[model samples]
Target: MPKPPGKPRPNSRPYTPQRLLSLAVHHEVRRKTQALSAFKDAEDQRPPPEPQLPADAQAQRHEPAAYARRLAMPHEQSWGGISPFAKDYARIVHSSAFRRLQGKTQLIPAGENEVFRTRLTHSLEVADIASRIASTLNHGSGAALGGYRINNDIVACASLLHDLGHPPFGHSGEEVLNERMRDYGGFEGNAQTLRIVTSLESRLGLIEDRAAAEFAIAQAEERPRGMNLTAGTLAAVLKYPYQLGATGRKAGRGAVAGKGIYEEEMPVLHALQALGLGLSPQRRTLECQIMDIADDIAYSAYDLEDTLEAGIVTPLDLVAPDDDLLEAIRSEEGVRACLGPLAGDMHRANTRIVDALTQVFASLFDLGDAYPQIQTDSVEGNRARHIFVARTYLESVMHARHPMVRRQFLEALIERHIAAITLVADADAPHFSRVSVEPGSRLRIECLKAFNYHRVINSRRLKMYHYRSRKILGELFDTLFDNAMERDPKIRGLLLPDRMHEQFRAQGRSQRREAARLVADHLSSLTDSEALRLHAQLTSGQSATFNTYWR
Candidate 1:
């Protein structure tokens, strides 16, 4: 070891391995030398386009993977030539990975209560909102988009496909995978989404054609193009334009933090950028921006409905929430950006945020005009009210109106967001349009979105679930990863699914990154119930024999 040229400062801190590892977390090149959980999800947290190689530099031998045009196994080019984006839409919705979203968590875990929105339902809502936003802009500001119209089908595909890569158990499950893959390329939902679409999709045709399946098995080292989507649709689905190992990434914070792409997929992204959007890495496609905001809008409005119905939160709670809660909401990741300069002014920010949210929250319930005013603030006062049978009966009717009132409120909120969406032309990127939400509308959206944080995401109630997610994913990753690392196909084969085991064996012992990725893909594909059942079988030797219906 050598000292620096500069004189050492008297107050300089000692460089322990932990201290160096902590700092190296931000430096991608240096962090590769160390393997620790602390380096988990180190990111710049910027939504799109980190510094990228010149468009030409990214051309890959795997260029055919981006579209259906030049695949070893080609699928239909168009869905009956219905629309330019129609084929991609069919590919997305038809993928088994997309269907598995029904079993994945969105805000709440799936199967807890069938009424709550799973990732599938949330994606559907986001697609609807994104399509509506596209339509709104097309009708209102189409002329402003420099003659290029926003396509509803593209936005729908992008929105529906966005969450396909999310691991089971929601973000907590994602965090666990990210931690396990810290020394690998790092795990992120978006990056995994790309991986799924490009390589890991379970093709149904292969199962029926034994010869095709054997051919796939023989060529396991050469990754298959999953859906073989058009370059334009691929570009539209990329919410974040950066990859994990980009030279520009640095540790930072956001509401959500994870990799956008892996090194394996960068060449495809580069080729797509050259062929499709051609915008700088700093900018996203017009449709991608619409899908991104639609995701936010869906999360903000729909999750609130779920929470209120579950009794985890109430309309009154948002109308007049605690000052601490308001501050906490404003403090959430990516939320301060919605506030502009007002973010720094805590007093003004809280007041304005609450004022905006109140109007939206206040409409979620209705006291029927026929019902006498009831005291709901206190149980004792409510007990006195119950003694008045007329009042009790009227209170039931008033509360009954909430089911319909909330539906109308939900409709109104979705409509408000759609109307506020407009295309703002960017001078820096005239080739593209920037999707802008009216500032006030954006503020209200952020304020509502933050509730998922205050009452659900960051709440103590989910601690056990988080703990379970970490335990299950950690052990699952290690079991599969260690099996692959040992250079024994039989050992890896027993633990991993047949496809992943072969993928790992094909990579051999030298391609540790590829091997680890196979493990990750296998784990990430498991639905919540599958993960739980697999965990039980792997750890306790007990199985869900009665419920394994296909057997």
Candidate 2:
């Protein structure tokens, strides 16, 4: 029988070695019980607030119906009702694009370690963090977000779908693809995410009629307008609203020239504008701002988590003053800009946090060296160690008010200089917003990024792998482009599945650019392992096996 809460266990053993163990266990239990009792006593001493609507419920009441309206489709008429935003969430969650994120890299490749985040896990984390930020903004003490209540579902869907466009091997692969398709409105992951959610993902199943599906298909023959997500959800995902070629035209300050929507995706962009999400040539919505920030937060926090678990960098290393790392941070253009006047503050805060973390880690692990070696061999042990390190670091940062103030200063710099939302006069483009990170935080993030950049990405060990991956992609791209130019059926078969091949063929000679785009898309869609396998098959002149062909 189980003992009642806070009840002492009856003594049953004599004072032997086994009895000593039992007493130790009982003493630990008693300590926990006393701690719980103290917690309860403290809670009982505090006065309770007057009962009212839960914060979330209050916030939901202010959310407008227009924000929930679906694009090109009516809400489902079911006894078991669901919000249109919920439908968007369901659709994205069910998408092949979303599922494929599991196989894609974050900082490190997936399957490198059990605790390391992949694009899928990272997306989920981003979604969670984005939703939290939205909820906080909506219900927290801040002034009612200037009459705009962020929808949590919309933010969540946007966050979850944000990295859907990232190809295999992560940003390296993205850079390679972007180079290959430079003429064809270069590949941007954010833009690809927009494409996936708006046009590439199918939503015909919701139409409930053959005619509607055909009409939808006919309206956009080259690429299908995907999930047909609500305007609010779509708006939240449009980190960059302008087309690729229009980068230089009246772009706002701090706006990225290279990252924007593809030319073909403009129709859907216009559709979103028509729905009153107020998309300009270069602006993103508040929800998008929140999601983007959430992404930053997650990446900044988790990347360190991943590196630590992999034993590539130690907490002690970060805390310790390495001239090389400091020089790298100082040299970064973005960091330099932010730390212009606040360089001293940044250094002080950075050093303080690092020192605090080093002390915490040293105390926990009883460090002998300046940089302690972390456990990474066993997955469970690595995870446990990572958790301890992460918790200690976070708690240290949070408690150290100076660092927090410096961080806030950095955030303020971003808000003041980098992030901007302008009210525009054009009826077609009502609101323009740009999201940017301030230099201080950006510098800190860049430094953290540089840790991986110097140690892992550009290291002798990984450089060889990157070089080989690049070669494989380059070769594949050249061969496929040649075949696409010749209109070879085998190449077409390799480029796309049967249904998509028919669509590609339907375009004829005019679709050469489209064919090239298709090749890039096919290459980008492959997992790292899949890309390697296909590369092997192509290079060796071996007939593709079931594993290589099926995906």
Candidate 3:
């Protein structure tokens, strides 16, 4: 009996190593080498390799794998469409864009605390948490998706690659880059992540092969770069399904409203939805839900962890007020203002955050696979109440809401700390601002995000740091470009020092974007100390002079 026309085959085999290797080699030969070098670097540093089966286990490894197996296979079976999820995952994991995250800051500066996380670590944690949530949800005994074959690979890959598009210096860098590129429609990390996965990740022939040459020719007449993934994966990776201006908000909507996929990526996104969601322009899929929940779980807990490790506010600091301070300020107004009276209150507030999270974990674990529909409406209501309740405690007594509190503990500990350290701003800015639950939520989130910017990011220290960094990167680019200018003698060639300059130069007018991208790529790959040192050397200008140890 033949399978129905539209449905996938019941069992499809995983792509053989020979097939995958062939695909990889073909793509490698065609790729711009510099970009491929960065991709290879990332591939080289993937935690540790997953265990491989012995030669005798080939039969077991070759068993048919399905759900979205065709998308993962190196060889094409029928037409052009490959799974979007697979492409997104591969794009994120393999691209230079993802590797640059390691050098980027998260909360504090990259060099601040050894244990404190950078953006790369934070993203990895988020991916892990998201993967767990998706796995539990998919495998859970919930009626929501009982009979469907949930792809674990899709969830894991999507979750891991989600943050690949963040710029340097964490949110601060993101803002500056967005402001700089506003004409390019302003960069959002999430939107950039989408762009990288769908379009920019294919510098090498990783997608183009002898088998795919004809397809590439057709596409070359269109867009040069694309992941060419299945629609299902693309839709799943998209948390916001609408474009920036596509929808009007209904009355009483919350922060979730006005969220949609970016307008620029619509063609690819729409193509993905049409295939995966089985809806034209209107509907979303189950995988999107998993991605969303995973994101939330990761953001809340990971931020808290980063805060703790940085020692900004401790469990003890929140719970206990200073007795000496209270005694010193004895007037009624002074006493009222003193935090000594709020020690117990802070303790309770901290407990609430822990309790709510504990409940979520318990609900996840105890439900033992039957947890997805466990009266989550009521549970979610309770969770929301707790979130507000805990926040209120911080607001009322301990003033734990201050950005300084969190910054103190961050590796980069932005300007919020400098103000506290310098006593420049009233220490209460972090406390005075309530978490806004406004429409678009961007403004409110920006407030928390902005505090970091106004204080630390734009602070003289960080600016100096960036200025120095830009100088070093600029010099490196100059040296490389000068070499190219002198040696290659190309008229009107750009001067960026990337591994792939030759290929970029070959492209002619498209060279500027490629140049900037290369610069971004090189700078993004440096560690904080490495960048600073390099900058120092570049500015020194002499050849290993008295002050000339590698910038």
Best TM-score goes to which candidate?
Answer: 1
Clashes of each: 1, 7, 30
How well does candidate 3 match the true structure in TM-score terms? Answer: 0.51
By TM-score rank, best first, the candidates go: 1, 2, 3
Which whole-number lDDT from 0 to 100 does residue 346 have in model 1? 93
Q: What stretches of model 1 exceed 4 Å from their correct place? A: 1-80, 202-221, 245-257, 363-401, 426-431, 544-551
Better of 1 and 3 by TM-score: 1
The 10-residue segment with the lowest total lDDT in model 1? 1-10
Span of 10 residues, lowest total lDDT, candidate 3: 417-426
What TM-score, over all chains together, does every model reach? 0.75, 0.70, 0.51
lDDT of 2 at 170: 73
Q: Name the regions of candidate 3 deviating beyond 4 angstroms.
A: 1-75, 78-96, 111-114, 139-141, 203-229, 242-264, 276-284, 317-493, 497-551
Residue 227 deviation, candidate 3, in Å?
4.9
| Global local distance difference test of model 3 | 0.44
In candidate 1, what are the lDDT values of residues 469-502, reduced to their tens digit? 8898889888767777785556754567655555
Candidate 2: lDDT of 380? 70
For 1-551, candidate 3 gives per-residue lDDT tens digits of 11112222246333344554555565556553533322121112112122233445333221112223222123233323434345446656666666666777766677676666676777676666546544554354233332343455566666666666665556545555444334434446676667666665553233222323323333432454545444445555666555543445521122233344455677765554344344322333444444554454344444554544444533333233244322222222312232235423645433332332233222212322433333356977567656654654444234234445344433232212112111011122211111112221222122223223333445465676666544554555555434343434363333333324555556654434444444443444455555556555655763434432221
lDDT of 3 at 72: 19
